[model samples]
Target: MIKSTQQSDNERWDGEGGSQIAELAKSLAIEELEEADRRILAFLGASVLCLWDELPDDARQKVLNRELVQSSFDASVVRARIALLFK
Candidate 1:
């Protein structure tokens, strides 16, 4: 499906928020990912807000483990992990 272009939140909303977190998630310096990846990451972040506690312990650990991997990571892998994270 096509993504929305309109403002999604008050004050700030452009999917760059996820890029900022992805930037901060690293121990060493890293460049921002493409906007699509950032948008996916932002959705992941948002999903975690609502779904984290609802997941079983094993599933949660599996996801957290995936997220703890290297910064030069694949967005698809991260997306899969996020999907599994909340499943």
Candidate 2:
């Protein structure tokens, strides 16, 4: 049925996206980190995640409002940067 086909397509797309994210994470990981550096990176990553998780509802709403105001200009600049890189 059409529904089953759509579900399978979605699952395939999700799998591909997940693999791409995993590959990016692998590429971003520090290749030659010392134990101390690795511990520092882990601590920083955990702290960032915790800080994000602890953001207040009003702060999040403000961020969303600011993003909405800036997104179009930001996106246009990003597109221009990408275009320059390709040129």
Candidate 3:
């Protein structure tokens, strides 16, 4: 018998990753983190439908500034929708 050389993503994450994330989330300051640890912070903050519920409360508060981003994103949609509708 031989050990498999490859492992699935689930098996990889079944180790200490969850605890590491929890520990990181507890200490993370999203504003500072986003600039410093961009991808990991982003991965922590992102969610389906833009909810970002996975982030810790402190990190979430600092990271989830959707009003401005949402407004800006919505503005583009609104602009495109009305671009030819009215003019």
Cα RMSD of predicted structure 1: 10.2
Q: Which regions of candidate 3 fall more than 4 Å away from where they truly are?
A: 1-16, 30-87
Q: Give the alpha carbon lDDT tens digit for every residue of 1-87 in model 2.
A: 999999999889677564544454465425455565555556755765578668887765553353353444343454454457557
Superposed Cα RMSD, model 2? 13.6
- Misplaced by over 4 Å in model 2 are 1-21, 53-87
Best by TM-score: 1
Q: Top lDDT: which candidate number?
A: 1
- The model with the greater TM-score, 1 or 2, is 1
Give residue 74's error in model 2 in angstroms: 25
| Model 1: per-residue Cα lDDT over 1-87, one tens digit each | 123423444225335354445454674222345566567677766887689789898876555453454544665665566567567
Looking at model 2, the pairs that clash are: none
Alpha-carbon RMSD of each model: 10.2, 13.6, 15.1
Error of 2 at 11 (Å): 9.3
Give the Cα-based TM-score of candidate 2 against the true structure: 0.36
Model 2 residue-pair collision total: 0
